[model samples]
Target: MDVLYFAWVRERIGLPKEKVESQAATVNDLVAELSAREDRYAAAFADLSALRVALDQELSDFDASLAGVREVAFFPPMTGG
Candidate 1:
């Protein structure tokens, strides 16, 4: 899957996106896997409440299924003025 990070998530991870190979069944599982890989990933996903997720561009929850999903994006909740 292609994992994408936006805004502060990207800043923390030090990259915009990357292809990941995993056996995760949900977004949260994927996060745990990434978080185990490094401190940067841990920091990026430290607080799930501070972030939002998308599966193939559609908004999804951390517990959402990852089956058949080709892309996953993580970013902070948006704000408008």
Candidate 2:
């Protein structure tokens, strides 16, 4: 799956996108896997509450299944003025 990080998450993880090989079933499971990889990943995924996830460009919950999903994006909730 191609994982994309935006805004502060991109800053924390260093790169904006990467193709990740994961056995994770759900978004939360992926988060746990990433968080275990390094300090940067841990920091980027520190607080799930402050972040939002999108599966193939559609907003989704963290517990959502990743099956058949090609793209997973991690970013803070958007705000508009």
Q: Model 2 over residues 1-81: C-alpha lDDT tens digits?
A: 999999999999999999999989999999999999999999989899999999999999999999999999999999869
lDDT accuracy of residue 15 in candidate 2: 95
Error of 1 at 44 (Å): 0.9
Alpha-carbon TM-score of each model against the true structure = 0.97, 0.96
Q: After superposition, how far is residue 7 of candidate 2 from its true place, in Å?
A: 0.3
Candidate 2 has its poorest 10 consecutive residues by lDDT at 41-50
Provide the RMSD of all predictions against the true structure, rounded to 1 decimal: 0.9, 0.8
Which residue runs of candidate 2 sit more than 4 Å off their true CA positions? none
Give the 10-residue window scoring lowest on summed lDDT in candidate 1.
Answer: 72-81
Query: Residue 71 deviation, candidate 2, in Å?
Result: 0.1
